[model samples]
Target: MSKKLIAIASTGGHYVQLSRIMKQANFDSNDILYVRTKVNANDTPSFENESLIEDVSRDTLIRSPIIAFQMLKLILKHKPKWIITTGAMPGLISIVIGRLLLRKTMWVDSIANTKQLSASGRIAKKIAHKTLTQWPDLVGENVQYKGRVI
Candidate 1:
């Protein structure tokens, strides 16, 4: 059977937050496919079912389409029942595609965003089924505070 969930995030803080959430959520690693950015040689597989895609951001708008296509293919290939992410551009892209495919989607704003939601998190508030912030003060009608991941 296809994986039950797709959990994605970019490198650094985003990936760290995703990892902590995964552990706390107590999901079976075998049932989730982890998607993260291809940062450097130091990056190694953290889970048996995982894939890495090129990292792109607002500064690299020209390549966003490529990242989106990659996410689409990844999502289609896995056919996950749900998609959850800790944000950066990659995770936001995955949520969008996951939603279009009718997959349940959730976005957790990085804990690094203490004062406000990140750009991707803001947009995700509109696209994802649930948008969460680590800071309770940042919560709004579209976003919920789920406590800190760090």
Candidate 2:
């Protein structure tokens, strides 16, 4: 069976950046899957396999457990070999689950976060197998500024 690649784009810009990487890498919808909010799913109709989750942020951290449950279900169902995301709560949960499952995980920090890594990305840097920053200056021991999504 082909290994599945998972990505969560919680914001509009994050979705666009993920889309760019999908196209740049010539990944078909079948080769990869998406986890996003309902609005983000509506924004990008190309990917057929998508899991829509409740959007949560640092301000709305109270909903993390619910979001985490949803992430767990996706991980159990898809069994993705690779997990990736742009900074956000649901994305953070996915990468954490991915790491626990021994899946290769990557966090591509948003280009909008030029000064520092996004909050979710910062957390993912500790758990994810690889964390990448869009800006060169923000590279750290755990987070690396390799290439950009946009």
Candidate 3:
């Protein structure tokens, strides 16, 4: 049987963290697609099973709608069994929409920044099928501490 499809993160700490977890999953490159803000213009590495979206910063009002449309398109096209992310604007939106669309969702808060739970992590606690936190003590009843991402 084929492994279930997944929508992975695209850039920065979230991307780095997600990449680590994805390596442990049974899914292959074709079984997952990446949704990131933007591709590094200089780093032209061959990305076979990835897609990019404009990175939505907190200051941009238009970020949500653009990300929503892109996420909707990817959800329709890929039909992933689960959507996973680390807290960030785009990740938060993806988790919410994924739940609404009946896709299993997992949110893992970044471990490096152990100081606080992100806004996305808080929202995910309310809606995600599973809210994964790195800090055991920081996890609430709604959240699950799944250990460090590394």
Per TM-score, the best of the predicted structures is 1
Number of clashing residue pairs in every model?
0, 0, 1
lDDT of 1 at 63: 89
Assess each prediction's global lDDT (C-alpha) against the native: 0.89, 0.80, 0.76
Give the clash total for candidate 1: 0
- Best-first order by TM-score: 1, 2, 3
Model 2 stretches with alpha carbons more than 4 Å out: 1-3, 40-47
The TM-scores, one per candidate, come to 0.93, 0.88, 0.87
Q: Which candidate do you rate higher for lDDT, 1 or 3?
A: 1
The lDDT-based order of candidates, best leading, equals 1, 2, 3
lDDT of 1 by residue, 1-150 (tens): 489999899988888889899999999888889889988857777657878888889889788888899989888888999999998898988888898999999999988888889999889999999999989899997999868888
Which scores better on TM-score, 1 or 3?
Answer: 1
- Candidate 3, residue 15: the lDDT equals 87
Worst 10 residues of 2 by lDDT: 38-47
Which is better, 2 or 3, measured by lDDT? 2
